[model samples]
Target: LLQGGDLSCVIRERQNSNKLFSEVQVLEWFIQLLLGVRYLHKRLVLHRDLKASNIFLKDGTLKIVVIVPGDFGVSRILLGALDFASTFTGTPHYMSPEVFTCSGYNSKSDIWSLGCVLYEICALDLAFDARSWVKLLMKIVHGPSPSLPESFSEELNHILHRMLNKDPMVRPSAAEILKLPYVAENVKVRSLFILTSL
Candidate 1:
């Protein structure tokens, strides 16, 4: 299992990165975003907390999102390729309600949250910031998903729409999403890039 250097080295270099949104290829960016998560699920792990901030690049040049162990202080537990989770946990704004209130959850919920993160990354705001977590969760469960802005790329908007599916079972798997056209494009793409998670 010989490769390059360690990931920490990459992390160190990434510290010098301006920001993920600046001068990054959309394909690589999308891959890193989803690959980071896919790597975890493949290891029979769930990120529990998948967000824009937590998902970071290593070398800032490889453009590959490598999943280490865990973040948010979550130690990655390699449980094999199983998809059952208990003792639910995750961030409120981006979490599947089941992660907090209910018992049944799995890697797919993380995918849903990833979808939310992608939506936020593209639109530059939290898609579900009603007033509080409770309000937001209710809205997510009862209200319609946030509509993609006309200003945003259609491909990205399509990907985001599929990710925000309320039913976890219906949400596209990260692997499936990585194959989308919006993700494969090698163009200079940019949106509002605003930060409101508000």
Candidate 2:
């Protein structure tokens, strides 16, 4: 039998009653996750199942852990400069518009999912929910873009808006996202501190 540890346990422990992460906590999560995603995309990998349950926390830090074989079942590697992946992939709640409509998708698809995850981190709720996958897809494709809590900084709201844009081409790449003022500053400082400690 398969034996393993998973992030769900940690998430449950940290988010008792689904408590929201504070701004500082969310920023820390964002910078570290952005670094991880940037590494993946630079190598042409698409982490199709990037949800809270798929992530593990250790020493107050998080890692994108592939819990099982089928856990990353939908992930793909780009064979060219761009890919038009036509199959519907990823969980319905975090799936992008193109994936829902089967129009085709690329790495930017992950950007949409990241936006949803970012919203969840600060709000402690899924960005969109419904009774069934079909209804959920309908909401994802047709529903207005979800909003972050009013307490979130405007910088985060603007970044999430671009990430969740309906048009995949319009969404920022992982590298571009890391270069954003908010992410760059925080991640840079964190990396420097780590370097000094080494």
Please give the lDDT score for candidate 1. 0.60
Q: Compute the lDDT of residue 25 as modeled in candidate 2.
A: 77
lDDT of 2 by residue, 1-198 (tens): 012334445445546755556777788877777878888788777877787777667677778854333554777777875766777667778889888888888788888888888887777778889998788888888888878888888999889889888888899988998899887888888889899999
Q: Using TM-score, give the best candidate's number.
A: 2
Give lDDT: candidate 2, residue 154. Answer: 91
Clashing pairs for model 2 are none
lDDT of 1 by residue, 1-198 (tens): 013443333333444552333223434456666766777677676667676556544444223233445334542464555546676556677777566557577777888777776666544566788777677778767677786556556666676777777677777877777666656443223222223332
Off by over 4 Å in 2: 1-19, 66-72
Off by over 4 Å in 1: 1-27, 57-72, 75-82, 100-103, 181-198
Backbone clashes in candidate 1 total: 0
